[model samples]
Target: MERLQKILAGAGVASRRKCEELIQSGRVQVNGETVTELGTKADPAADVITVDGKTVGAQKKMYIVFNKPKGVITSASDPQGRKIVTDYLKGINERLYPVGRLDYDTEGLLLLTNDGEFAHLLTHPKHHVAKTYLATVKGVPHGTALDKLKNGIMLEDGMTAPAEVEYYDIDPEEKHATISITIYEGRNRQVRRMFEAIQHPVTKLKRISFGDLYLGNLKRGLYRHLTKEEVEGLIKLARTAGKPGNRPTPKKDK
Candidate 1:
């Protein structure tokens, strides 16, 4: 049994802190009785739960791969008044959120899901989920600059782990080069920052591949569910790279 508030929060009802307020305000009920207790527990699968008179049930777990278009925010909501990725998924019934994050200016493959455990597994750094990107930068980084990126660059938090970087193409006249970079670590704006460190700012960044998943032919703003094989591959990869004490045991999906 899990705390009622945590269940509600995990269902995207509200944050845990806000769920506490909702409970205290008598807006929550369990098994047809108003529950104002802060520490109320309920079996999400069996309990009759409601919030503000609307029945609350366990949401169906959904996993979707989206070919995210540029200029759309990855977040569910943006205070800065910008278009969000959720706006494109209007017909979808499930309330899904982007698994990790891709900046507004960056584009390409992104995963969206309501499975909190799966999201945690994919985003947690200890999993070492590899992300590959195709970046077009202002300058062609050669020799020493390439070495620095491949070896590792010192960031504000600490030194980044070694990355795989190779040139896709170079246009000397335009002073730009298309480079492929694969990173196992996810820090905030890491790909962009890595290029900036070498004085070769990235003009465009698109994640081409993530683990065993790829953008394929999915058009921008379109999404599709992962195949059974794809899901199994990801679970295996996560288990292999997950932290020593926190590795997730593979479970059969119903």
Candidate 2:
């Protein structure tokens, strides 16, 4: 048995939080009776659940790794008709939510899944699932600025957690540089903001990896389902974060 919200989210009805709202609003019924309590649980297989009188059936969980191209919205839908990440997921029927968001102008490894539990586990702040990005900045960051990024930067929200930062390439003539940074926190436009704070705004950015999962060779706008082993490995990585020896220095992407 699982929580009713979990069942609804796993069935692709909506996110877990939205499903909980649906339950609280008296839209969900279990075994032909309305279930408005937040603590309600039911066996998904045996219980006939409905939302707005429509039956909710279990859906096969899907885990996909998408190489998100720039200029696409990270959301499942866009009102202004802008292309969204889901639009690139051609022929896949499952309603998969992005595990976390990448900026509309940012590109690279993006995880999508119908499994709410897995998505939550990976995205929770305490999990510290490291995400690595390669950013092309307007100016080459000097050692002092890089060190400040490696330590922490005070943002409007608060002092950001320490990040792993290293410069990969420097073009003196263009005054541009490419840097690889790994961060544990999932703040909005964090990488871009970090550089902006250092007075070297990012010109381009691409996420190269999330935890142990790498974007590797996957062309932009293409996607592939995660192998069982890969999915399991991500779960283990998130679950074991903060334990002794679990925090290793992030490797720079070649």
Candidate 3:
């Protein structure tokens, strides 16, 4: 028997942490009895598990790489009726949610999948999966500003970890520059905020790569299934990086 949250996560209900919240909130029922204990375990094959009165079982896992267009929400659905990432996936029958988030005004590579465990493994802060972004900012920052980003930046939340910054070309007339920044954290609007901290607010942003997956000319609003090798590689990377002593110390502002 496996933990109920694990079963629910494996069945695509939500991430393991979210599933725990559902259980504690009394939204999860097993064999017609409400269970609120985090330690509760059940045999998925034999037990009748229902979340919010809807039965859940093992589903055929699907992994997709999407090139999200700007102005599209990264959620499964939006109450405001704005366009969502799933709106691009018209024919896909499986219920998939984005593994992480991209801002509504930022476009780039995003992953959608029904495998909640996979989502948690990659997104949990301890994993430190690297994500690279190409940011076009308003002004050309000097070496000192770029060094601030490379070492760390103090944001609203706190001090950011050291990032990999690649200085690219600048448009002399436009007073703008395109720089590539890679970060391990998935904080909300992190890249944009990082540039803003350096007095170079991002005018445009696009995620170029996530871990082993590259966006590579995938047109905006289009998506494709992940190959077996790509999925395995990502899982291996996350697992390896999550091991003890593998995580990086968040750089303090000096």
Best by lDDT: 2
Which parts of model 2 are misplaced by more than 4 Å? 242-254
Comparing 2 and 3 by TM-score, which wins? 2
* Among all candidates shown, the one with the greatest TM-score: 2
Estimate, for each residue in 55-141, the C-alpha lDDT of model 2 and write its tens digit.
Answer: 999788999999999999999889999999999999998888999999989999999998877888898999999898989999788
How far residue 116's Cα lies from its native spot in candidate 1, in Å, is 1.1
lDDT of 3 by residue, 132-246 (tens): 8888999788888998988889999999988878666589786899887888898999999999888889989988788868888788889999999999999998987733223
Give Cα-based local distance difference scores for all models.
0.82, 0.89, 0.88
Candidate 3: stretches off by over 4 Å: 172-174, 242-254
RMSD of 2: 2.1
Q: Write model 1 residue lDDT over 24-127, tens digit each, in one string.
A: 99999998999999888999989989999999877766778998999999998999989998888867977778878999899988998776666767877888
